[model samples]
Target: MDSRRAFLKKTLISGTGMALSGSLMPQSLLAASSKKITILHTNDMHSRIEPFPDDGGTFANMGGMARRATLISEIRAKEPNVLLLDAGDIFQGTPYFNFYGGELEFKLMSKMKYDAATLGNHDFDNGMDGLLGQLPNASFNFISSNYDFSDTLLHNQFSAYKIFNKGGIKIGVFGLGIELEGLVAKENYGNTKYLDPIAVSREMVQQLKNKKCDLIICLSHLGYSYQSQKIDDRKLAAQVNGIDLIIGGHTHTFLDHPEEIINKDGHKTLINQVGWSGLKLGKIDFAFGKKNEISYANSEPLAII
Candidate 1:
């Protein structure tokens, strides 16, 4: 799970509804009408079917699946162009996972109408068999570029990327995962081969660009950062180009605000992560002006409460 407690504690002290004003807009699009896209996200929920206890804690009485579902439904009601996504670690925290082995998680997420989701290493805790066994319940797509599941049961079960058409706006999304070698138990992972996430992500992004996607998003489980040479989300953002946003998980980093880093092409890339256990839901509203320039950007981390 992400440091939801840490992020919530920081954000509450700083103030809520923090806004970013004055985004760069193309002169040609200044007079044109705008299109709105709302991106809603969560990560590392770990099958928390119920809200946390009311005991004194940062996430107490927060992060119930029902609350999240209600919030998502309300948002959809307000905005027709919305994308609901998850960054992974959807299994193995609550008793639901121990008893149902992720079936409940998949079923619920599917019912929530998730646009897409990536996989976390913990997703293999019950072994590849367990993960693959419950695939039928999830109606959304699983996009991953690094994992070569060809020899495993997940071969055709995942995609490297997907392009979504929303109100004439083309949004492309891909997924990247962490190295499983020594991190994941061999028996649990089976024959799944992990590749270089950065390289694969770059390639996928390039493909999406060639397809002329209006927006590109990367769903990553490669932890926020590390002292070692391990590649993290920040490193990926700096090394790659054309990625508009990186929604990350693993290491459960709760970011109070989205970090904007310059990518290889010198364009800004936004990276955000919500704390784990479904404690918070991340929402970003993008207003696209004429000529496809981003006119406004606002992000809010909604406490499950």
Candidate 2:
């Protein structure tokens, strides 16, 4: 008789627990308490190891690699979920690149702990051989969804995409380069096939989404806009979907903040660029709150001067 009574009591308790659990809050509600993410990015640094000389130009005495390093370190110290990234054109500006053939550029960027970078037209100044020679110095990876390097020295050095995990949030980053037919010499980008950026970008975004990335970013050497009908960042954003941000280069455009555009799926996409020559460092703070939603986005352009 005692055993029968206990069994009935246990059944009632289990039913009550199941009923309560059925009304439990969703996972997003639990994510309401979490840390945020900050993304620091740059483009077209072009080997400007030191600040531009005090020649009375607009950017004179502004933009030195050391200053950028300090700024990045300070941010990382304060924010555990910080990502430092670059677009392209990491080489071929100052006497350093001319003298050392891109070795110093990779070394400095590695020191700065750049997560990933794309290829720029100017990166091929000394040809594929020169780029391959300096590849060993880079601690970070290279990403490019397009620009097939089959049958070339760079065939295995570059990856199509990479994923970074921070604070339980996943960020998928990829790269896209401009068409090389007219921009680069045949011998410079030898055996490299330039695929359609729009198509390649779509594929990458789908893959990133499959990986359940909270953020998807593209580092592109395509310019911001074009007077002609040539495809640029703006057009690319409109044509594609699932890319959260595009850090652009090649036109050296300076933007104080990111431009928001509606994508094919009608979602907001952001595009940002800092002028070339390492004159500006672009910083964007994205606060991820409940449900991994971006509660705030703040972008600042740092003057090297």
Query: In every candidate, how many clashes are there?
Result: 4, 2
Q: Model 2, which residues run further than 4 Å from truth?
A: 1-33
lDDT of 1 at 290: 71
Clashes of 1: 4
Model 2 agreement with the true structure over 68-104: per-residue lDDT tens digits: 7777888788778888888888888789788878876
- CA-RMSD of model 2: 17.6
TM-score (C-alpha) between model 1 and the true structure: 0.89
Q: TM-scores for all candidates?
A: 0.89, 0.87
lDDT of each: 0.83, 0.81
Candidate 1 — which pairs collide? 1-252, 2-252, 2-276, 3-252
**Candidate 2 local accuracy as lDDT?**
0.81
RMSD, model 1, all Cα superposed? 7.8
* Best candidate, TM-score: 1
For model 1, how does the per-residue alpha-carbon lDDT over 85-110 read when each residue is reduced to its tens digit? 99989999988789878877887787
Q: Which ten residues in a row have the lowest lDDT in candidate 2?
A: 15-24
